[model samples]
Target: MTDITRKQFIKLTGAAGLALAGGVGAPALADTFLHKMVRKPIPSSGELLPVVGFGTSRVFDVGRSAEERAPLLDTLKILYDAGGSLIDTAPMYGPAEAVVGDLVARLNSRNKSFIATKVLQNGKQAGIDQMNASFHKLKTSHVDLMQVHNLVDWQTQLGTLREMKQDKKIRYLGITHYTDNGTRELVEIMKQEQLDFVQCQYAMNARLAEEELLPLARERGIAILCNRPFGRGALFNKVKGRELPVWAADLGIHSWAQYFLKYLLGHPAVTAVIPGTGRPDHARDNVMAGMSPLPDEAARKMMLDHLHGL
Candidate 1:
């Protein structure tokens, strides 16, 4: 983290203290003492990214209404206030790219954010058109990262992305997939292409990535953006009536969301985990997972074992 980020965190914690004295809540107070936000370097460029980021899929595909956008605005504010910058979206997520652009514009956070959008079309021309549309919807001339969503026509789209990078329209290029079925192909592409990043699903409940995808990313020096960190909410369903283990408090984990996110963050190869949420409180809770004292390999194994028993 930068000195500016430390100052921002201190300032936010001071405000949280005031809120606590005003009887806000213990949870708010707990947030005040979290360690400095954790950041990991993008292996390709060495640019530091906060370990926790928010994703825009179903949650961000809202119409243009203050009523619909109010919570989203709060969510972005919470994310920025906690020093998080990466925001993932895609053209396939109906209206999500627009919603993110509008909200980030409203918050004046485009500069502070590392916005990542995708190309989901087939042919090269179609991919070019789709990426251009993403640039408009994201309200930015140049995107921080542009990815091939679900690897749809990955070869064609990747060629287009490389050209865009050369043209300075995108700073980095990557590919994404959400299931193990794509792991083999994803690995082959990683081996063949000089990608900067890869977004995929990874969580305690979804560990298929650990078998190959993650280690390969490490070896290839590609940053990883973990999606579906909660296994698309399947992990929560499994622990519906369960309580967090006693050791969770040692790692500053107060909620199950943080528990799950910290587990992913514990891994060395994970660059960041983008958990989707429209709720400000959930955003705040998720950002807390990026704080220090993450689980070690031993603790991660314990977490997995505990999850299995539940």
Candidate 2:
């Protein structure tokens, strides 16, 4: 779609060559679309993941009624239908983990979903018990990515997770934190631990990770997942009622959501940005940010300067 050769496109998306040229796990609806999401390699194993993913934090804790779930169903449909994966959820996000499990089961998309959930309890056995509940709730035998949420008893949790990985109960394990103050601890853990991923808060407005976490993640070969890419919606408030910058077309951005998300995707260390949403339209817009022609350094600087102006 961006005039890229098929080989280049494969390279960009980390697609598995011509075998998946048609896209291996792509939803049927995606066959008609030419543009697929760009994928970044996981620094640990070199496996690729689309750079835009869905986050379920307070957004997916919905009622059981079909009326309430109709929109969320459409949201997941739009994501996988656009060749996107990587759904980040945590047991702490109320019903989000269960909701995701239920919705994905209803859609019969368990294999299609990249399930990443967290264990938040403070002790090793408590963490194991919680993770067991997550598996039962998510209805999965092997989780794709499991995390130690907010680093709560992270050392113990990591040890247990390593055992799970050894037992094939989980494929990969990582660490996450939602605040800036936690970076020092996170950095220390990253330095000493063999983690597969690191989830941290980062966005145009929240660049605390850029000072150390991001670079350190790259140095350590740990994949980075950015949360709060919208600065917890403060970014939207900043651009409220303003027209999208015309030059955004140069970077393939069509909406402020894409603009904000593209800024995160442009960072070298980011494997994906999991923006939580229950709306189909919002999910669709978020996925577009992972397509080709992301902003370069100069354009990212320009975009940041514009945000500073606000």
**TM-score of every prediction relative to native:** 0.90, 0.88
lDDT of 1 at 159: 88
The reply for model 2, stretches above 4 Å from the true place, is: 1-33
> Top TM-score: which candidate number?
1
For residues 68-116, write the lDDT of model 1, one tens digit per residue: 9998998888777777899999999899999999888888888999999
**Deviation from native of the Cα of residue 14 in model 1, angstroms:** 26
List model 2 lDDT by residue over 250-303, tens digit each.
787766777889998988888999998786646666777888977778999988
Quote model 2's TM-score: 0.88
Clashes of each: 0, 0
lDDT value for candidate 1? 0.83
Best by lDDT: 1
RMSD of each: 7.4, 9.0
